[model samples]
Target: MTYTRVCPLAEIPQDGALAVEIDDTPVALVRSGEGVFALSDICSHAEVSLSEGEVYDGTIECWLHGSCFDLASGKPTNPPATQPVATYKVKVEDGDVYVSLGSDE
Candidate 1:
């Protein structure tokens, strides 16, 4: 899979998220204590931007309905989201963040 550079690693705040678009795919770049993760920016339950929400403990909370999704697997850890969002592969190289849209990891 081809990985496209999204943004600088410094752009994403620690324990927070940032929204980016690669080839028209909206991706939420999340930084947790473990590492950086990439997921679909839209929340599965509300079709809202997940990057606008809060990130804690490797989970991103949906701002609209309080749904929390796990960054690693894109699984919803809390309601009102039942379905999981899409997750992409993420890599950091030379202080830059890259995301692969070819597969839903």
Candidate 2:
């Protein structure tokens, strides 16, 4: 699979996320526990961007509804959100963040 360069690793702070559009898809780049993750930027329960939410315990909580989603699986761990988001594959290369439209898990 081709790993496309997205952003610099320093752009995303620890326990923070950034929204990026690739191929017209908004992907959420999350930095949790010294790791980088990519997921669907839209909240499953709302049209809001997950990047606006806060990150804690490896999950991103929707700022609109307070719903939390797993960074690794994109699964909802809280109410008000039952639908699962799509998580992309992410890799860090020499301080740069690379993501794949394929798989990270």
Candidate 3:
């Protein structure tokens, strides 16, 4: 798997999220607790930006329809969103965040 540096660790607030484009792919970088997660920025139910939503308890709620998605699995934990978004591997090194879009496996 190839990891690409997306942004600095400080760019995303604690328990918050950020939208970044890597290799022409829109990804949502979420910070929950002390871990960082990467998922598709587009909401599976509404095609809205997930980064604009609120993050709580390792889940990100879609601001448009209130659909909440799990940051770790990219699966919708709430209604209005039955499909799961794509999740990528994330790593933090030297205060920088990196993401790998190899496989969900």
Candidate 4:
């Protein structure tokens, strides 16, 4: 799949999330442990940005309604958000982070 470079790997804090945009589509680039993940920046249950939420244990929680989504699956792990968000494939190369927005699988 084609991948677009997002940002330097160092830009993302460990266990934190960064808000980015690709082709006008908002995306959240999350760093958890040694792996980096990408997801729709918008929360499934709310019109809020998920990148403004908390990151923990491979999940990102929605700040508006306490909805937590799995970083890898984009599936909500709690209430107030039964719908799952979209997840994208991510890769790190040469200290840079690249994401494939077209690869939601």
Report each candidate's C-alpha RMSD, comma-separated, in the order given.
1.5, 1.6, 1.1, 1.3
- Which candidate order results from sorting by TM-score in descending order? 3, 4, 1, 2
Candidate 3 lDDT over residue span 1-105, tens digit each:
799999999999899999999999999999999889999999999999999999998899999999999999999998999999999999999999999989755
Per-residue lDDT of candidate 2, residues 49-92 (tens digit): 99999999989999998999999999999999999999888889
lDDT of 3: 0.94
- Going through the candidates in order, what is the number of backbone clashes in each? 0, 0, 0, 0
**TM-score (C-alpha, index-matched) for candidate 2:** 0.95
lDDT of 1 by residue, 1-105 (tens): 899989999999998999999999899999999699999999999999999999998899999999999999999998889999999999999999989989544
lDDT of each: 0.94, 0.92, 0.94, 0.93
TM-score of each: 0.96, 0.95, 0.96, 0.96
Q: Residue 89 of candidate 2: its Cα lDDT?
A: 85
lDDT of 2 at 21: 91
lDDT of 4: 0.93
Segments in model 1 whose C-alpha atoms lie over 4 Å from true places:
none
Clashing pairs in 2: none
Question: How well does candidate 3 match the true structure in TM-score terms?
Answer: 0.96
Query: Which stretches of model 3 miss by more than 4 angstroms?
Result: none
- Which model is ahead, 1 or 3, in terms of TM-score? 3
